[model samples]
Target: MKLKRCFDLVAGLIGLCLLAPLMLLIACWVKFDSPGPALFVQQRVGRHGVPFAIFKFRTMAHDGTAGNVPRMWPAPCITRAGHWLRRTKLDELPQLANVVLGQMSLVGPRPELARYVACYPPAVREKVLSVAPGITDWGSIKYRDEGSLLAAAADPERTYIEDILPVKLAFYQRYVDQRSFWMDLRIIASTVSTLWR
Candidate 1:
């Protein structure tokens, strides 16, 4: 895990350097395209269940609900710029800083909203939160089109809590139990491939 953290720190710095120009452009576009700041900061449950602010490029309209609402796939207020950013996953670029800062990992369970963390079944939550939350994981790969999947549901939030959340927890626990450098490499490769698809 020491090596994993070292890789995360190094890769995060490199990623930020390489993607800085793109992030800047997106930030500028978001500001002009929406009525809110370019960055969206939210409190998320981190390693050991500590709260930390995770940063992403603001991809929803200013008027959208600030709460950690479950159906985040599509909101009426999403600007045109935000839509493309989300589609390409460019919105997640800012989180590289979180990686550099040691608040996250490149390949671990995705961080959940604090409220969602609170709702986690006790044993599952404790096991899942044993490690740092990550930018991507097994569950994320499986649910790559999560927004569209939720949009197809009759009750998106209910579907998420009942089905999606549990599956994610299982995957998270799997990662927690089986995590290693090679596994992280595979997950990174998978994520890159998914982004290209």
Candidate 2:
């Protein structure tokens, strides 16, 4: 775990440094493309049941519900820039800051909103939250097109809660039980390849 933390810190710092220019360009584009701030922060359940602010590049239009529970895909609130950002997964770039702050990991179970975390069985919750949340994970890689999946659902949130969440929980448990430096590297590589494709 110590080594993992060290890797996260170093990788996070390096990522932020290397991507700073691109991130700044994206931020500016987001700002000019919409009426809202470039960055969005929302509360998320972290390791040990703690709550932390998760950061992202704002993809939705400015609205009172922006920080509320994530809405289903193909909703009207998304801005023009949002479509491209979400499609390219650039919306998640800001989470590198979360990684640098020790609020997240480079590879682990992705964090969830409090409401979703509350739905987890006690034992499952305990196991999943044992490690810090991450920007990328096996669950994330598998569901890279999650928005499209939700778009096809009759009740997106329900499908998420009843179906997707369970599968993600299982993946999370698997990650928790088998996590190591090499595993993290593989997950990261998988994520990058998934994105590249």
Candidate 3:
């Protein structure tokens, strides 16, 4: 656990350093492309069910309705730049700050919104939240295109809550049960490969 935290701290700092210039460019692009701030911050359930502000590069229009999980298929609120940002997953880059702050890990179960956490089965919630939520995990890898999947569903929110959430929870549990430094590395490598491919 100590080693993992140290690794997360070091990796997060290094990532921020290496990615800062690109993040600035993306932030400028987001600002020029849309009317809102470059970063989006939302509360997510973290370790031990604590709520923390998770940051991401803003990928939606300036409308007040930008924060929640996608409720609409073909989400009409996405901005022109948002389309590409979300597609490339560049929208998640700001979360390195969260990782640096000790609020998140580089790899683990992805955090969920409070509403979604409330729906987690008690044992599952306990097991999953036993560790810090991560920037990427098996669930994230598998559902990388979750918004697109929901876009194709008849009732996107319902499908997310009923179908996708359960699968994600199972993945989260598995991650917690089998967690290790090596596992985290594998997950990170997989995420990079997945993104590149």
Candidate 4:
């Protein structure tokens, strides 16, 4: 995976450089819109079930546990600017730093909170945790409207645990079984197209 790591380093550095202005702008907007730090940090399950602080631009109000639950306001805790950032996935830009730091890959299973990871069956957990978690993966593209989907659920957490998470886990298992450098490139390309279109 030397080449994969190199690609991550190079692409992450380039992406960070290119997105600097936008990141800064978003940071400032988050600060102005809310009463908390612009960046949100949370413990996520990484490779081998190791926990790490994943970074993202804060898209909610200063409430400490706004994102801890499955469903919040459709636009509840979000600020005016936060809405745009979340919609465009710009809030995820800081994860390039995570990639550069080797905590994540460009394409792999999206890291989950420790609470959710605790629910993963041992074998499936090991399979998904065998690789570094990613910022984007097949599950991500397929569930790009996850917030909206959750908003429509009678019980968001239940629906996620029973329905959504299982499907995502299947995708993660498949990705782990079939991953390659070329596959990563294709996933990234597909993500870009999905985001832009």
State the displacement of the C-alpha of residue 81, model 4, in Å, after optimal TM-score superposition: 1.9
Better of 2 and 3 by lDDT: 2
Q: What is candidate 2's lDDT per residue for 1-197, written digit by digit as tens? A: 89999999999999999999999999999999989899988999999999999999998888766787484554677889888888889999999999999999999999999999999999999999999999999999988888889988899999999999999999999999999999999999999998998
Alpha-carbon deviation at 182 in model 4, angstroms:
0.8
Best by lDDT: 2
Greater lDDT among 1 and 2 belongs to 2
TM-score for each model: 0.95, 0.98, 0.96, 0.95
Deviation of model 2 at 88, angstroms:
1.1
**Which candidate, 2 or 3, has the higher TM-score?**
2
For 1-197, candidate 1 gives per-residue lDDT tens digits of 79999999999999999988988999999999979889888888899999999999887777546545432755675678877887788888899999999999999999998777887989989999999999999898899888778878898877888989989998999999999999999999999999999
Q: Candidate 3: worst 10 consecutive residues by lDDT?
A: 65-74
Off by over 4 Å in 1: 64-74
Cα lDDT for residue 65, candidate 1: 61
